[model samples]
Target: MAKGVWIVAEQRDGALRKVSLELASTARKLADQLGDEVSAVLLGSGVEAMAAELGKYGVDKVYLADNPAFEPYTTDAYAQAITKVVKENDPAVLLLAASAQGKDLAARLVGSLATGMASDCTDVKIVDGKLYCTRPMYAGKCYGEVVVDSFPQMASLRPNVFPLVENAKAGAVVKFEPALGELKTKVVEIQKEASGKIDVTEANIIVSGGRGMKGPENYVILEELAALLGGAVGASRAAVDAGWRPQSDQVGQTGKVVSPNLYIACGISGAIQHLAGMSSSKYIVAINKDPEAPIFQRADYGVVDDLFKVVPALTAEVKKLL
Candidate 1:
């Protein structure tokens, strides 16, 4: 029977992503609630050192699945390796970040194990002795508590919603060997996006723009503010669909979910679809001309004014502080 909570640690370029640590921190909370141990599954080539970081977040054990073929993210390779680990350990709960790689892995895991999974969960906890997960539905207009009838309940949590917590743990590292399988798909090319800017998921402050910005060219002001603050830039679906920003920068129901300490929505109308993605942020600031905009309802601070005039002034003020 599954006993402890397990976190699937994500690594890229031999470095563990912040989501991995965040998920481990979240797993620690759930494990404490259930009086269960928190374990981690780290898979990659020469990634044994990454396991030590998980131990800092209260992990009881780190199951290392090291392999040369696992250097980069390949769906077939990762799924097969993770499946092997799950079958062997049978963890009580499996937590992963709802990232593109994570979503693909979760779906593959569900197919392999024939188990139910809740995707892009916003909240998770044990309720009445069963794992209850809260997820947005109908484009964030509604929410529901989901229960998976599988032994090892699986859920992919949205990034940034959970804070990374640190706790001392003498986690024992256990190396695991998986039965090798033939690669079904080959990665011939990898086009990496220019990402020197702050990662949105890891940013402490985020300033997002929407249709109210009018055009793609108008995003310069938003970018300036974000750069000054050392924050990441985000966009609404409308702005993204208009080709103002890359799809990766979009933050809404059909885009990335982020929870930062400060989320500044500039010119965004605050549709429920968009709110579903960022309502969990610690503090929200909305800037829109319409005083009655829906986003103002959720914002901790609301500025009723034209973004064109207000944003530049705000940027200047921020620049002065710098």
Candidate 2:
């Protein structure tokens, strides 16, 4: 029979990602309800030392697969390693973050492991001794609930969707090694962009702009404000499609979904697609000249003034304060 709850604790450069801790906290809550232990799998070259950090987030065991082969996050190598762990442990559930890596790993793992998998889940609940997960469907037009009908039920929770609860425990580090064969594909070079910029999905504050900015050059004002607030800059589909911003900066149904503490929409019309992505934000501030703009309806703070004027003023005031 499947036993403990397992989570794939993702890491980059030997540092655990925030979503991994979020997954551990969710697992901790689920384990409490199911009367099982919360365990985590950490796979990286020198990530064994970070197991203790997972303990603070309520992980009880850290299955360490520290090897040089797992350094660059090759798809097949990770899939092989995780599948081996699941075969040995027979966990009741396997959770992963809905990140680029997590998405790839989870899909490949499920294909080989024969488990029902849900992606981009916002909530996981224990319903009548079953793992029930909620995720957006139909392009976020609505939500759907799912229950995995197999052991080692799998789900990838969206980043920032779950709160990171500080429930300290003994995350006993258990060393394990898997014979990861020669990877068919290998990463040669990784060129990270805007190295200091926080990930849009992971940022606590995000400043997003749309077509109302007139052109790409006007985005400077938004960037200035974002820099002042130490936040990431995001763009709507309209801005991205117009070639004003890179596709990576898009925030919408076809883009990265974010649930930041503060989301500032500049010149964005609050289209359904845009709202579908960031409606979960704790607080929304909208700045648009059009009074009838749909964004005003959802914003906690609305400014019916041209962003050209308001944004510069806001940035100047912020700069003064800083």
Q: After superposition on all CA atoms, what RMSD does each candidate show versus the true structure? A: 1.7, 1.4
lDDT of 2 at 292: 97
Candidate lDDT (C-alpha), each: 0.87, 0.91
Residue 112, candidate 2: alpha-carbon lDDT: 79
Candidate 2's residue-wise lDDT over 13-93, tens digit each? 768999999999999999999999999999888787789999999999999998888888988999999999899999998
How well is each residue in 71-160 modelled by candidate 1, as lDDT tens digits? 778889888988988888888899988987898889899888778889888889997656899988887777888999897899999887
Model 1 lDDT on a 0 to 1 scale: 0.87
Supply every candidate's count of residue pairs whose N, Cα or C atoms clash at under 3 angstroms.
Answer: 0, 0
